[model samples]
Target chain A: MSEKSPEELYAERVKRVLDVAALRVPDRVPVFGPYQLYPYTFAGVSFKDAMNDYALAREACHKFQDYFQPDLDFGPILAYPAPAMEMLDIKWFRWAGHGLGDHVMYQYIESENMTADEYDEFLYDPSHFMMSKWLPRSFPPLAGLAGWPAVRTFMWFGWTGGYVGLAAPEVQEALRNAAAAGEELGRWFDSIGQYADETKAKGNPQAYAGFDWPPFDIIGDTLRGTREILADMRRRPDKLHDALEIATKIFVEYGSGAAGAELPLCWIWMHKGTRNFMSDAQFGEFYWPYLRKGMLALIDQGIIPVVYCEADVESRLEHFADVPPGKVIYHVSTTDMVKAKSVLGGIATIAGNVPNVMLLSGTPDDVREYCKNLIDTVGKGGGFIMDAAVMLDEAKPENLKAMIDFTKEYGVYQ
Target chain B: MKEQLVSAIADMREEEALQLAQQMLDAGEDPQAVLDAGKEAMTVVGDRYEDGEYFLPELIIAGDMLKAIGDMVKPMLQAQASQTEPLGKIVLGTVAGDIHDLGKDVVGFMLDISNFEVHDLGVDVPPEKFIQAIQEVNPEVVGLSGFLTLAFDQMRVTIEAIKEAGLRDSVKIMIGGAIMDDSAAQYIGADAYGPDATAAVKLAKSWTGGK
Candidate 1:
């Protein structure tokens, strides 16, 4: 047989993943590169350099792709622009060289960015609330935004006085800071886009186009925080439900809008709805309804929702069975993959069960054995994508090579 | 009243639990009795967590209720000049280069309520800081918490530092976090690994010779 071109290889790879997504047995199980900071580490790039230098980040990503050659390319999206974060003075995360060691990956610092009693205000006008409340509290450079008038008041005659708020010197300075940070972000996105195009040209398609969060996580992770939002579940159940309802609409729109026609997949990282985060009953009440709604909305847009279950979600597997067949992908961490296959197989694509700890600490033979077991079970008869349980950062090179190479060789379907 | 307080806390009626505790104290009840009821309620919460009836949210709210009630009754208890000793002393902190505190704080709260004097060194604690805390606190048990993969090395490094300081034998160390398991525990040279805060409390209880 003649050697296939990159275009042929790319088309075949995309078909393999899409076929698996639709519950058909593809040529072989797709192996996603379980990388977040691992590429930088593999390429000998410091976390500080990766975050600050977009070109270096792109090089690191390319290095990983050329070496490992996984079916899907892990893009440079996780390498956030340190310059933009510095300009915005964001409090949500502390990246390397800013608030951490030069080699340390960025860590999210969760706090109560929104108060409990302000749910009504947030539900009333999320745009205004974000501008006047959330943004100011999260971004110190945007503290002047707190002085701005309600965004809704900027219409008609209200514009005369509303424009006065924007004229304030601090607000102007805030606008300048925002503009500068936005420009830096645009450069970062350009760097990522360039990497995506380059990888695609080399027959390696990116896994997902963009990312979103469940409505409950949007409130819990970014707005009210893990502790505060969980407290709100008991303190003000009604208000919490109302806020989730509002957040559901916003996220559905945001998620569907982020997907492109070429790669219609939106990644949603499920954080607070895991097994130990809440009771199953609480998940039913506050989490599943809206998460299902968001997933269905994206499905309606012909976009696939790749839900990454962060912790053991064995208890919540039944809740996921409600989704449409073959339209969602559940990439899980600590979830029982055999049970996940039994519950979600043929209904939705199931991916991941490889332990991150094993990859980081175990031997290559251990990784091969684990992957062989997973292929025999979860990867049986297709509809499974092989990936690590979590986003890998510091993994042994031999173990990672074992996971990828073993999955590709052993995951063939008859 | 004590039964009502316990049920209120266990049932997650935060306002009622706080109000009921204040009412009991106002009625000239023993502050220790009120504190004991709070502890009993936490025991219920911990049991529910073990049975999977409760989770992090319940633990947090229950912890907050106990802390609030304790804040209210502590001064009064001090006035009476009667205080019981803690079960044991524990030095706890999230190891170096990791800032994740939700799990660490949950473990700390569980340890605190279980009657361990927890000298919480907070997040991103270096090896030297752990050594300093161990020397100052002289705890019977030490807990090292880390949520990221990078923490495995840090935990090992911190344990080595403790060993270098010649305090390794003085304290029994147990590590807990999301990514931790028995293998990690062995790799980090800790005495044990607790999967959750409840298990952590159990480990502390077993090590300190407390029920």
Candidate 2:
């Protein structure tokens, strides 16, 4: 018999993932390897070099896939373009070779990019707010955009005067810097795109086609900052609701548009809305409605929404039952897998719960034992994916190998 | 009035809490009483937090209320010259190479409200800095905080440095973060691991024999 081609393998892996998403039993439970800088570490490549050199980053990612061979490939997506971010002077992230040591992973710096009183302005004209206010605050190189006239002003005779702002020397410089950054981003995307194609050709499917955040997180994480947004819930609940409403629509469009049929998954990193961050009532009121709406919208577009619950979301599992059966996957971090399976068992696909600390600090035997238990319980029938509780940055190499190899071996269906 | 103040703060009535605090000071109430009431309200907030009724937002706003009330009464309390001794001194920091500090800050705030003098060394604190702070402050308890996986080694290294400096036995060490647990605490050679700020306060209080 002729051996299966890479295309066939790719199709098989994709089907395995989608089968779990649709709550059907697959040939075996798929294992997802979600690591940010582990590949660089494993390949003996410095994060600084990878972020600066796209080719080296791609090599490191390919090397990692060649070794682990998990069903889904992460590619070099987390190896952010440090030079482009530097040129733009983006304040949201501090990457390697910039503010952090060359070996360190990038860390997000959160602050209130938008003040409390600006909700009205943001709600009224988000584009102007982003260009004139948010962008300038987030990226210092774009500070000149603050002086540019509102886009709405460019009507009939206003268009002639509106073009005047573009002629400003600082604004011109900002445009040049932005264009240069865009070109840098284009190069980075091209490299990542090539890596994805190569990995697909090698029989590995990429995890997510696009990424998104819940509207509440978009406000809490990027706009008002976590503390400020939470306070806003008490101080200005009405305005917060209005802002979330706007964000929901914007995110749905952004999420669906970015994802394609080639890989029909939109990854949403849920930062807040956990039990420690808010009450179940608060989550229901401020967080869940819009998130459910966004997920349903993405599903309407035939894209599966993969929500990575970052923190302990055990108490909030019941709320996820609202999603359409077999349409969404909850990649939980600190949630109890037993409870998750019972609650979301046939309702939605569940993945993860392996303690990252175990992978980092435990022995290979410990990792293997834990994986066996997870496979026995969470991976009982079907509709579950094996993964670390959180993205791995530092881990014991032997332990990671044990997790992947053990899960693949013992997670077979009868 | 004190019950009103407590309930106002505990219920997260930020504006009303501040107004009530200001009103009490204007009425010439003993500054210590207002401070005591703020502490009492914080305990209620902490209890709710432990019970999972209140979360980060409630804790933050409660801390803010206490700070405002402290500001209002500090000068007056100083003029009276009747400040009580703090329960204990605790050195705290988010360990080296990890800059995430939301959890650390919350722990610091809770410790401060719990009446421990917290010497927060801020984020990305190296082992040498921790040893230096340990020597300088001579704190009763040291809390190491980090939210990332890399922090495990850093925490172990920091504890080792503390031991090398001959200060390990002098202080009861505790580790706290989202990723921390008893096993990690054991691995890092800490006396205990607190999952949240409340747990940190409890550990500190137990170590110092404070009520």
Candidate 3:
């Protein structure tokens, strides 16, 4: 067995991915790379350092390829602009040395940034509400927004005292800083795009085209916060449903715009809709309908939606039956894979559930054993993409190496 | 009227609850009675949460309502009743590296309703702050909360800090949040693990012997 050329590797990888994606048994099961924050950790570069300097991040990516050489890589880590966040003095997220020590990772600060009584205002005009209300409250630097006139008044009438604030030195400084940060992030993303192209040229394929949010997560995570959103279900059910419907409509429109493109993949991050988060009835009423609608629309436009089911979704797998078979991929993180495969085997390609705790603390043998079982069971017929339960970060390199090695050998179809 | 107050709160009718509290106060009802009614309503809320009828939003709204009523009734109680004692004192935070706090807030609400003095250090609390809070609050128990995998290490360091400061023996240590199991609790040197907000209160009561 001589080394295959880059062209051969790329062809073989794409064919295998498309085969399992269609629930057809290809030559073997495809291995997925969940390398989220691990590349920086592996390169001995802190998350803050990498976020501040794209060169450090690019260096980590180079290190990532040298190690696992995974079949697919998620686009970029710390895509958020650290400099913009620093300039804005944003309190919603804390990076290294900002809240924790310099070596600690970044985290999002969850707060009831939007109050319960403000639902009507938000539902009426989301753009104006976000710019004037949510932005100022969530980002400290944008507190000047409260001084601006209603966005509707400005847009419709085109003359107001709001424009005066734009001339203030502090507001001007904030605007300048934000614009500079946007340019910085644009360059960063461009470099990452170039990196993706280079990796594709080297035979590793990119899996996702763009990212979107499930309607419930967009509401719960940013708009209402988790606790507030859940309470609205009982107290203000009508308002909550209205918000979900609007969110679904917006997502479908945005998602369809990217259809029939080169990537043709929509990554939907699923949160706050699983069994652990809601009751079966609550999930059915509040979550599934809106999300399914957006998914079906995306599918109608020739886009394959890959739903990343976070947390325990074992009991909620039945809700996915509405989508057409082989048009979706469900990447679940903490559910029973055996049960998931039993439920969703022919319906879609099932990925993930290798525990991150095992990857972080366990030995190479443990990693190999877990991958072996997943391949033998879920990889039996087809429609199984081997993945980690959580995004791989700070995992032992040897353990990750063992997982890839074991999957390549044991995942072969007889 | 008391039953109505409880029903209003348990049903999450905020305006109705406030009106009921005000009406009862004007009719010369004891402020302590009003406080008891609020606690009973929270008990119902907690029960609903465990039964899957309520979730974080319910808990948050209920907690907010209870605080509103408590603020109104507290001044009157402080002036009228001088001998009433709180159930217990506990210090809670979301640990050093993690900022997720939905579970922490729920646990704090449960403890607040149970008449415990809860000092929540908020999210992304460092180990030194835990040590500082333990020294200042002199709590009977300290809870380290986190939702990510890295929180395990933060929990361990916080517990170690308590031991180093000679406060480990004075306070019971517990850990809670997502991604936490018995093994994780044991690994972090916690005395016990609570899977939910209600269970956390139960564990705290057992440790304080219903003080």
Candidate 4:
């Protein structure tokens, strides 16, 4: 595909919008990625090659939008210190997104079960180590071929969260130490946020939450680990309330960097660990309230929250059924798309219900039928955006083209 | 039947209006009459949900009323009457190795209003507990929920226990939550599957018919 010059394209000034209190026309359906395989692959660039020199990725994004015409453009070169730049004790502690198990990184675990005032053990601290370079490893062997479907799976893997600020254990002792770590994490954001704003990271100053929480990798580390904290809400309700109140307060203070008021942006949030499969009572009695409060604080701070209700959220809808529309967007899964559209349609802009499996496994006819049905069924009013239930991996290039072609032919209302 | 009892249930203070429903039932008011009253409220809530009028908070309140009234009304009837009661009985809980329970709470709410007698066993329930509950309570259906991969193993143990206890045929079983699929239902030997609370209630009734 040939390219379009900056002057040739219609300008819909895009920037990361942190305020989520209101809504407006986003230049187009925002395209995002944990891996921008479509761009990198076209450039004859491996994720590894792009790591060597990232600007080479610009053409790939332009070409993809030229071909696929996504409203939002994404870049996969999320910066990290190169692999050997720091004392990354990868051999000892594999990085698992500081606390909430995000991804792979310098995982030098300084101590184990340090919950009982046991800092005497080796303490894992990023302050002690130099910045480790984050180099992208190879794509799957099948990927990067001319026609291979570009599927970039970054939901759980592409993570690098560590002692940016004090994690769960250090939150108690050295309160000052935790603050220092947080400040350091904030300072590190200068470059990351820059790349985030780079025309490539889908940087739209007018965008939302720096493209949905700067990758859950970074947010999960900062927001508070969900497993123990949310579980505590049930085991000890009052204490959980107190902890959640404090955590919510902290979330407002720290999480303000993510989204904004005018236009809410959200990740298609996914994780094997914390999905919507928990019992309804548990979602109600324990987690939803805490999450509701955190979101309330964010909305109060003038941010609109688009929750990509991951997995089967059919059981949890009652809790969020009251969330006001124009402030919420739900990226739905295939498990209960009909009910989701029925129950959540008026309150949240329906973002998706496309079948991820069908795109890869189905033929052009099957893909066309499914996507057309999705658009017709989910796209009844104007609030719908065409997208997959989850991320699109290296899909059959032809299938991806089929989707793009269909959207172009059928998406316009004029 | 009066409408105030239905309003009270929607208000989640079933205890306050329990007498109204009892009065209706005692007056030779058909069980269908009492059910209609509750369902009227639930229907509004369910419609509100479909129309995006009601949220989880309202649903929870509606469910609370149903459970409270259900508990109050059951003792009034004889044991044999209990078997032929308003929807069939369901034993619901979260799976093992996972302590989360909110989804189960909503499922309980959905089942109760759909007219099932839901015996909530709470979260982190092991396989044997499910087996014992099925035997002692003799529910017509068992609804199992799991959100964790590790808990899938427990879901298996639960179905096996049902089969092992020779109670599988007597009771149709259902499974739900974040990670489970129809295949999982087949793998765990579930008779039915619910992707969400609304669908769960509907699926559960399809098997037992609120008998």
lDDT of 1 by residue, A1-414 (tens): 028788988888889888888888999988994478899999999989999999999999999888888888877888889999999889999989988999888999898888987888898899889988898999999888888788688788988998888899988877888899999999999998899899988888887766899999999988999999898888889999999999899888888765555667788988898877788999999999999998898898888888987777888999999998989888867788999989888899888877877888889999999999999988888989988887888889899899888988888888
lDDT of 2 by residue, A1-414 (tens): 029788888998899888888889998988985688899999999999999999999999999898888889989999998889889988988878788888888998889999998999999998899888888899999998888788798998998988997798988887888899999999999999999999998988998888899999988898899889987878899999999999999889879864566668888989887657788989999999999999898998889999988777888998988888999999878788999889998899898967888888899999999889988888988989999988888788888888888888899898
Model 2 clashing residue pairs (backbone): none
Candidate 4 chain A, run of 10 with poorest lDDT: A130-139
Please give the RMSD of candidate 1 to the true structure. Answer: 1.8
For residues B19-78, write the lDDT of model 2, one tens digit per residue. 998999899898788888888898888888878888887887887788888888888875
* lDDT (0 to 1) per candidate: 0.88, 0.88, 0.79, 0.52
Can you give the DockQ of every candidate in the order shown?
0.71, 0.69, 0.41, 0.05
Best by DockQ: 1
Worst 10 residues of 4 chain B by lDDT: B76-85
Cα lDDT tens digits, model 3, B1-211, are: 9999999999989999999998999898999889888888988988888787876667778888888997888777757654347778999999877878777887898888777889999988988999999999999999889877787777888899889999999999888875666766777789998877878888899988893
Candidate 2 has a DockQ of: 0.69
lDDT of 4 at B40: 79
Runs off by more than 4 Å, candidate 1: A258-260, B78-81
Candidate 4 lDDT, B68-157, residue by residue in tens: 656755666544343335678889998764556667877887777666889999976888888889888888888888654434456878
Q: What is the TM-score of chain B alone in each candidate?
A: 0.92, 0.91, 0.87, 0.71
By lDDT, the better pick of 2 and 3 is: 2
Q: Put down candidate 4 lDDT per residue, A278-349, tens digits, no spaces.
A: 345555654566566666666666565566555656666666666756566556555466676677666665
